[model samples]
Target: MNRIQQKKDYLKQSLSLLRDKFSNIPADKSVIHKVASPLRLEHAKGIVADAILKIMNDHNLQMLALLVNSCRSEVVKILNEYSEKYFKELKWAVIDEFGSVILKLNTNIATHNYLLPPLLDDLEESSESSDFYAKSTNYFSAINQNLLKIVIYHWRLFKNATEQGYLSASELILKSNVSQASVSNFIRYSLEKNYLLKHKIHNLYKFNNNCLEDLLEDWSFYYKNNYGKAIRFISYDTTYSIDTLLLKVKVLRDHNIRIAIGGFLALELQKLNYVSDIPDIRIYTDNIKYTKDELDLIEYQSQDDVTGRKIIELVSPKAEASIFSHIMNKDIPICDIIQCYLDVRHKASRGMEQADFIKKSVLL
Candidate 1:
């Protein structure tokens, strides 16, 4: 049978097993909750374990099945351990039952496409402070605690950065209440992974904009022009490594003209007092160090703010000429005439109309 039929059959079998277990319990609401709660807790633990198992199986790591199998038993033992050692007032059995039901519902949805009927009812009862016994269960409590920590950390960092000028690595450590070593490791890892870039000025770090732009350009190009035919220009920034930039260029080599620029540097240059020519692009190493300039020619506007005047001048137009001269200097060889025409047309429509005329006259 097909994949759909196979999935449906598997789901049917699982649901049948679940139904049998479900029917054994009493039908009264209070009695049902009391009995099914433990089952729900166990089942939730099982679902997480199963998901882990499926991932492990896919990765050929099924040797860890022992650890996976111990999940439910370990959870139960831990609950019991806590109850016996710490608090006599804690009702872990109820927590376990509620968890099992939630887990069963989650797993059913995941594996069998079955929806839970009691979720809304449970949520309603749990919403009220008077229903603290119903709401403050271990499973939900753990999830809430972990989720809150993550959300709060992210929110606070985001707020601090936007409200304040910049957040340093040390600042992040203090704000996060994490160790300096841990923060250092995180920063190092992020830098290595190209997730963040460190500005050399004051050791300030920021999210990598070049990576984000490249991702956007890639998605846009793929969706807009699937065919490997024409030149499309993509704007990338300084955060990209030479390798990453090259890979993106190669993907679009057949049909794209990628424009590399120091996006952050460009924005920052506007604030600088120096009238020095800004390089068109800046290349960075995996270690986040500026290695060498990729492009030869650099250009910039004059310090004098002239309206609608040609205040900007190319610093190394000859260098630029040498670069493009290698590509376009020669007459289009006879064999490449047709391809050249198409290339010129594509580039022309993309605002290189002047190049189209030059190519047609020189090549034809």
Candidate 2:
């Protein structure tokens, strides 16, 4: 967080970005003009020495001096090549963290500008630039997931205890296992936000008319924002009708495999009639690995040819099912509308539109 630490993170990120950018290039290729190109660093690629000099000149002089002065023998040797004045760009330079240059630069360069390029991101979510949820807009924010967790926990508890017992704030703290300070803050915030209502008889707490829905949305968005990559996309050889999907799911269900359709499939289940290139069938399964036999069984049962099937790792399969309704009387179960919305909200395709429509018509 300090000036020096910030700069170190910046340098590391920039170096990492360059490494990722040219990851496709052959490591042992002649693109590198190393004083002695080590096998490990043969893959290194980035702006040429001239550009580095340009970067050095454009940036702080003190940091560059320290970079040069603190160089390890290898870095010194690398810099030795750049000792001579060069004007034009060098095609492929070895911009690797080969030596202790990073540590040396940090120790020697006392001060540096923290300005740097954006960091890399996960594949699917990073590609999505939707304003659908406004999670990043900071409109409705939580310091941590604790608030949502506590609220959902208490809501479920209240429902279970409605007949025999009356729940109070003290009991909530005891049940939540959260700190007293945090508990008090959450209670106050929920009350102020009209999410919680106090029972007149025993001062028990319950959700306001729409509090439960909002709480679930917050929870889903939290997972979607933090763990979108888990929603793995798959292709199916053939388009599946409701009857075929039902059969496929029933086969898995009979085997006790936990499965739920999400993404475009869920939209179809919800009767949205949304169509796609191959009908992105995203299924959340608890099973880490599936057998070829099981898939073959599904194929035999469904009789619907498919191109591909994408798999998304579920954070909490049981929890998701508990919050959403299970498809009725189907050979297999499908995720309720809420889970479907969460699954596709972060997708890069027409995912936002699907999620939004579901949220408005089904979830809300």
Candidate 3:
């Protein structure tokens, strides 16, 4: 598709999402038509701005509630400047994109009416052609995955060092196996964010212990942002227990499968015994097709699918090599402590409990 067509389609999808979110409120089709019109393609920014203004005017309360919860600082500033009454309502809307609750309205309103945050997120993801639209919905766009890798590398070094070690860009590039450009960017960002304390006399960087919590929080979002939706299969093997399945998978190591175990199974492998019932087994691999083909011999999609079966999640991450940056236990490969924490923290099935146990007992 042409770029213009793609942009129009994106605008239409964004409008459709807004309609789905606020089903009770009738959509202003006139404003939507103006926003989605191919003839007005050159004036995309103006069209979007006009559409937002119209939406705000039409559904003032809903727009106000969403803006207050938005991560875009500029949007919040504009809302505060124009609508002072919503200032009091701001305190109740202190929720992030990943949070379960966004806004707490005292009045009776449909819960779905104030879902503009996700719509804004959609725009931020799809509207890269226009800087105006992108900046208007900018939400945690600063979190860099390369920075996450560098942070992990620094942490690994920090734990073993007798004294706090200072990081050099060249040394970082060599140790982390990241590109030279990425290392330079990470150092600059770290210095600005105080993730690293810079030496006054020499150009050296040391990891700031205080920023560990914040970095981990960013890593959680990075993990979710990248590998949230994974390709999974329900392995209905009534023949083998979860432990037995682990053995079956481990034997495939000889086939040159780049697999690292994660989720509840990783914790179990460490003999942490934090969880009694494992919901699913998560695996990170560079080669999905190969992994699936080999594992299919033991358990594959069959006509006899049923409930109470084990789930196997096959996640292909952008950082394929980093997934294997783990410590082995009893010949079982597992994702490192930090990766495992992020993998299970956001899960709904008592995952936070397990993650908390890891954080307090291991990470802390």
Candidate 4:
């Protein structure tokens, strides 16, 4: 069979084993809430375990098979009309593994596909309380920058929560700007690596015992490690004096060019006690033609490696704006402290030493 069929078969087998357990599932609202809790997928496992029990006892397993395939929504609609009105109250769902998630779906994302369900329902619920999931912790990854941005937006959520040990997939979806399936994958990674714990809450997750300091340290490490693709030198030119550099800046500015001084030059312009023999004249800009033609830059074919003291032009690897609100030398506009710090972090002979000094002196 194809990959989708193979996955389907795997899901069926897992469901069949649990088919008989649902026969005596408790009907009490409290028990049902615990079993069908949308906060975490684990709680939904009870539904599947009960599904297996009910399926085995019945001769007509057609409906049960559909529910087993993650098609919970359709099953719920069908259950509503079934002769047994009690079935309407039954929360039938499937619990299986897809990527890092132990999926608990009472419904498939769609009837045509056999994949996991979307977290739209939970998303609606999240609109009611956005702060519950963000205060104590934030999710950031070296592998995904978009997800990192989403986490950054919600980082404050963790700080506000005095005791937030459980996070649901829906909260994660909204917080991370990721889809339900993506949230499941990341949760699986967090759980397996022990960053989060699968707690008592049905669909919620718990911490795996790492203390606050350790968690913060790991996040810091990931941030620095994945600050992502190093500085890119798109074009460069040789100019010997600070006066010429200022003139070039004036030219770019006169032409309505958006540019900002960065790297060691920014440090020097800031009047910080930074010592450098070959101070880099770095400028961030959207337009490269003006500088390349205006300054007569010798094209350096190598994109990964190139340097120039007179002038170097770069565009952000992620298309981030070159915000130059800070003015360092009265007339010369400079990039923000963070941008300047990164620009020289890995460049020049004494770049690291300067970066350290800049970080402690300005950024700290």
TM per model?
0.17, 0.40, 0.59, 0.37
Q: Please list the residue runs of candidate 3 whose C-alpha ends up more than 4 Å from where it truly belongs after superposition.
A: 1-150, 156-164, 297-308, 327-330
Q: In candidate 2, which residue ranges exceed 4 Å CA deviation?
A: 1-194, 200-204, 209-217, 231-245, 273-279, 291-293, 297-330
> TM-score ranking from best to worst?
3, 2, 4, 1
Report the C-alpha lDDT of model 1 over 1-364, residue by residue, as the tens digit: 4423332333333334445645432222211111121224465444334434443445432111111111234444443454345432222211211122112222123212112211112333324422433332221122222222232234334644642444586777655555676556556544543435677878866654333322222222222232232111123233444345445433333333322222112222223212233222222111111112232112333433332222111111111211221231122101122112222233222313422343334321
For candidate 4, give the lDDT of residue 78: 40
What would the per-residue lDDT of candidate 2 be over residues 1-364, giving only the tens digit for each residue?
A: 4423333444444444444543522232212222222222221112235345654465322122211101123333344355334522222222222111222132223312221232222223323322221232332233324344444444544554653334467776665455676556565555644556667777766755354444444445455544434433232334435465557667877787766666676667557734453235666666634622344323322313334433323333434333223442354566655556666766677777776776666444
Best by TM-score: 3
Please report how far candidate 2 places residue 134 from its true position, in Å.
23
What ranges in model 4 sit over 4 Å off?
Answer: 1-239, 301-311, 316-322, 325-330
All candidates' lDDT scores?
0.30, 0.43, 0.54, 0.45
How many collisions between residues are there in candidate 3? 0
Clashing residue pairs found in predicted model 3:
none
- How many clashing residue pairs, candidate 1? 10
The TM-score of candidate 4 is 0.37
Name the Cα RMSD for model 1: 23.7
Which ranking of candidates, highest lDDT first? 3, 4, 2, 1
